[model samples]
Structure formats: structure tokens, C-alpha cells
Target: MSRTYVKVIPTVALLLIAGFSVSAWLVYSTSLGTDYSKYTFPLWTIPEGSHMYTQLRVGDLNGDGLDDVVVTGDYSLEAVFQNRTGGFENRTQILPSGSWDGFVLEDLNGDGSLDICALNATHDGTYLVTLSNSGTGAFAVASQYLLGPIRHVFPYRSHGSDVPDVGVYLLGDHNHIVLLHNNGSGHLTPDVYLSLTARNILDVLAADLDGDNQDEIITVQDNGNLTVWSKSASSRQFSNVSRYLDTVQAKRSAWLVIADMNGDGIQDVGLASNIGASRGVLVFLSGDSINVEQPIIERYYDYTWLGALASDLDSDTDTDIVLCTQQTVLVMENSQSGQIGGEIKFTGFITPHSPSVIALAGHPSPALIVLAEHRGWYDLNLIDLVVFWREERGILP
Candidate 1:
């Protein structure tokens, strides 16, 4: 890098004094092509430096037989894009402006219309807000209640409601889980806070691990071990006994993704690890938990693999993998027999942190949405989220 300075000013100094001069500078970067040719488009973008700490949630919120997307990265700039045929259109903004942490789309009200439940922020305290869907892409303020800061928000059914209850992970060093109960009218009420671990947990996945009808809470610690807590639907509290996979560093990496790679009905788990002086991924096979100490698949790339998503990237009908690296996206084919093929890396991303795999309405194939924060940390003044799609394999069946 070289330091150079050019001086040019006052050519129109008298014009500036006469209020008739202007000076401005602009820069732009050209987009690149991915490894595979697919249907890719930019749905929407916000002001630069907006933190997409939470991934965009895609589903049918309006009940119009199409998938819509809701993004809450820019606090007071929450926007919902309705799946208009094969393309997405800006339907409306969830919040005009403000500091909102995260949000979830669930039927907070039993009105058969899916509502927006968001974590609103304020100077005093963060709040839980319920915005009812008046129609497709239309949301009205249902209720807003104050509480502590929320890192992650998941929906669960408690208090005997037809809809699921709100499960939140508090933002703190301590590992505490709070369940906010609904007062039957779509309003969230304060409920019990349960302590799950001594230290902080990375992420929470709400799913039914066993074949049982009840839902279970799965949390992964930094060390890569997992703890499964059975939830009582009626009581709305964790069961006294919990299941644990106390394997010795089964997940040697910081990232973890759960999916059934072998076409099994049960959901298996994948824990990423950087062991043997290289990057690796361990599989905690769901049924009998196969190869506990050994990893079913392992691979290394040039940069850091921040996150991984389990999806059928190709039309093979088997679950493939999408790895979100610091600079590119890698697609690995799953042999469906515990083997992974070589990596097919895709470019056109700058400091990409994570990627979300979603099926848009009208589009037959699932698409990958990656939010990039320029080259390093998130800058509130620059923004870019690219979408990659395929036409052959429509979204998962």
C-alpha cells in the first residue's frame, strides 16, 4: 500500500460562497458468478453495517399458498418480502425503525393467521412484541411487553394454547432459559426461567429427537457436547430427567448442524470439529448413535467454516451439506451411507458469516441466502445479502 495525497479545492470558492458548488465521491464493486449456474437474485437490502445476527425466517405467513421472508436485522427496519410468484416483492416493513434483537413467526393468536413475535429493544429494557398478520404481508401491533435482552427466540406451546409457547435464550454469560407464557389473547406474560447449564450455550434447536410426539430442547455447549431436555407440554417445564450425549469431544469444532443425512426418518446431528490439526465434522447418527468416537465425514478449506446447513443441495434426494466459510460457500454431496464427496466450493462472497437455506414460494428449488458484512466486522453503512437458487431440485419434499 502506498500513501498519496491530491489537493484540489476552491476552484469554485466564490461559487461555494454563492451556494452553487458540490463535491461527493462514490465507489461500487461488481458481482461475481457462483460455481454452479442457478437462479440467484437480491431480494432486499438495508443500510450498511446493519447486523444480521438473526437469519431470515422463510415460511407461508399470509396463508396465500406461497412462502414469504421476514428479516429483522436493522432494528427499526424490519421488512417482510412476500413471495410474489417466483420472485420476492417488498410487502411491508415489520418495524419502521428501532433496536430489535430477534423475532419469530408463529400463530401468537389462535386466529389461524400466523403472527410476528419479535424482541423489541429500548433504553430501559427489551420487549416482547406480537404483531398480528392482518393479511399477507400486513402486520398490526398486537402487544408489547418488557423484559431482559434475548439472544435467540424459539416457539413452544404452553399454557394450554393452540399455538406454541415462546422460548427465549437470555443474553448473558449465565445459561438460563426463559419461557414466556401467553395469556390466551396473544399477549405474552412473564413465566418461569429455568437454568440449563453453568456456562453459555451456543444455539438451541427445537425438535422431537425420539419418535415421541413431545418436543425436546437440544443445546450444544462450546466444548461440542449436547444435552437433550424433554419438555412437558401440559406443565410447560423441562422434565426432571434429561438425556445427554457425554461423548469425549464428539464435536471438536464450534459449529453444529442437525439433519438426517442417511434418509432416516429420525433427525441426526453433525458437530464440526478442528481435530488432528485439521477441520473435521463428527456425526452423531440419530438411531443408535453410530461411530461415537469417530467422525463420519471430515474436510478442510482455506478459510474458517463458520456455519453449516444440512440440506439436499442437489436433486439426489439425499441430504447434502452447505458450508459457510469466511469467503465462499461449499456444497458437499452426501453419499447417504455415511460418506461425503469432495467439496464444490462457490465464490462471490466477502467475509460471509452464515448462510440460510430456504424454499421460496413458486420456486421449485431451495435457495441459499448469505449475508456478508463487507471484509471484516459488520458495518452499519454497507450491506449485501446474495441469494443462490437451483431450478432442478425444488425445495425439499
Candidate 2:
């Protein structure tokens, strides 16, 4: 063949191959949902004293524009600051040794800085310790309120106010709920309190489930009972109550999360339970009425799930679930019709606890943070921070 003909043939073949490669990639990107490309081996390990880390959260604590991690454990409150190199090597202690269970970050004093409300539940009594952050991001103990026998405290905001109200869920003999109003002074006082007959309360969360301006308090209890309370017409307290039973065979609710699972505007409920034969994951689709007979999406697995978090892992508009089971970590994608779609699994994580989605310091997209018992190269079984993110949105230095 002539030289000109050979060169022309090679050029045409190259053009066709390039065009096909681009087409293939487009199809794969559209079809491939929930692609968690890489997983880091334990970002931070718990030492001897701090054994079990219960809660983990990431935020711009120092106002450096880069997100930092804050964790709570048995009598421990630590912060992992992200440095200039995008590495979390600079560790600091936020609060002195105390039995800190969980905390919420909010601007309690209206200083535009996120303050910390660390809840301490001890045998003496339960207390809400408010840590006010100065303009320079240094937090000092501002005030403390004695909330008797409350197991969990969550932030509840209503009427579009910048100030957040605190929701306290009382367990044991109290068996009640209280809404603590923040009066722009870092002091939380009981504004409204209600007594409930529901026993064995596992978790309590607040959200506007009916798209109403008012928020509803949802409580997951034993014997497959899910009770919701709405603010009364007087707006003084939560008096209107509705109860749902046998929700996905979830007798004993382990963990609960409230988010819009589907693209629908209403927020749905997610539950994880390891009670007896009912060990599985369940999602309650919120409609005009969330009754006991409401539709539910459930999946039963061999291993018990520790917790589940909702995030749009595939860039799909709808939310998906990331479950941390004792056996492994599973990512369940959402379908176009708002059902559970594909499954993505990650192994080798022992006793994985909480799975959270946070925007890391260097990553553009949100990353998944899981706390798991890792037997690392040192051969020590310690709770480690397992981080994972999508490959396309690479982690920057």
C-alpha cells in the first residue's frame, strides 16, 4: 500500500476509537451509581484510655474554611484539626476529661461561631454543658443546665429562627420530652415539657414530616412502637400525638435517622435494629398520612447493622443509605422510582459503628466516615476512623 493511504487509514481508526471511548464512559457514568473508589486505612486511632468512640462530626470549628473532625468517647472530647497540608495531624483537646456522651454544634450566643452543647449523663444527674466559642474559635464553658435523666439531646429549630432550641429525650423514670429554648445567651431553659407513656425509648429525633411549618418529635420505642408528636394549636407544647406499630417488624429500634429518602419533599424515617430475628434495615416512606399501615422498604441481612446514614452518594438527586454492619459496610443506592437499587460493599471492617457523611478538608464531594475496630499493622484492636470518597472528585492536598 502507498504511504499516504497507510497514514489516512491509521488516522480514521484512531478517530473511531476515541469516539467510542467517550461514548462508553458517558454510559458508564450514568449507569454506575454509588462508586466509592478508595478507602483510607484509619485516619485516627483511639489510644488506651479512649477506647470506644461514640459520635463523630466534622465542621469548620476554627473558622479556617477547612473542615475538622471532632469526636466523643468515654470521658473524652477531642478535635482533629486540618492543617495547611490537608492532613489531620494537629490534635487538640476541646474539653477536660468528662463523661461526654454526644454533642451538637450550634451558634447558641448568636456570635456566628458554632458553639458546643455537650451532654453529660452520669449517675448523679444529666447536665447540658454549653461551650461558647469566642470569635477566635476558642470554646470556654459558658453555662450548664441540669436536665434530669435525659439520655439524648438534639437541636430543634422552628419558625426559621437563627437560634436553635434544644430537644431533650428523657429515659428511665422520667419518660418525658422537653424543648429547651435558647435565649441568645448560651443558656437553655425548659420551654415546654411533655410526659409520655411509651417505654423503652431507643431514639428521639425531630423534623417537619408533614411539610408543616411546625416540627414533629418522633420517638422510636420498644415493642415496634413509633410515636410522633405535633405542636398543639396553642403552640405551647407538643400535645397532638400519633402512634405507629409493627413498622417493618422493627420490635426494638437500634438507631434512627430522619431524611428525605426519596426525591419527595416529605422527610422519611430510617431504622436499624438488631432485636432478635428482626435484625435488618427499614425505611418508612412518609406520605400524606404516616399510619401503621404505611408502605415500608426493608432489607434483612445476616449481620446486624450498627447504624445508617443518608446521602446522595451517586450524585442522584435522591438520598441513599450507607449502613455500617458489624460484618461489613454496605452502600445501598436509590432507584429512579425511589426504591433501593444497586449495592456497594466494603469489607474488613470489624464492629463498624457510626457512618457519617462530611465534607473533608481537601475533598470537593462529601466523604464517608466510619468508626470501626481495626486490627492494624501494630496488631492492636482499636477504634479507627475509616474514610472513603469518590474517585472522580479527588482529594486535594
lDDT of candidates 1 onward, in order: 0.53, 0.60
Q: Per-residue alpha-carbon lDDT of model 2 for 15-42, expressed as tens digits?
A: 1112111110010000112132122323
Note the clash tally of each candidate.
16, 0
How does each model score on TM-score? 0.70, 0.78
- lDDT at 103 for candidate 2? 83
Worst 10 residues of 2 by lDDT: 1-10
Once fitted onto the true fold, the runs of candidate 2 whose alpha carbons sit more than 4 angstroms away are 1-53, 84-86, 135-137, 232-234, 247-253, 345-365, 372-381, 394-397
Measured by C-alpha RMSD in angstroms, how accurate is candidate 2?
11.5
lDDT of 1 by residue, 207-233 (tens): 655656555666677565566666665
lDDT of 2 at 269: 72
Which whole-number lDDT from 0 to 100 does residue 48 have in model 1?
60
Where does candidate 1 have its weakest 10-residue lDDT segment? 20-29
Any runs in candidate 1 off by more than 4 Å, and if so which?
1-54, 80-85, 110-113, 157-162, 182-185, 190-192, 232-256, 272-302, 314-318, 345-380, 393-397
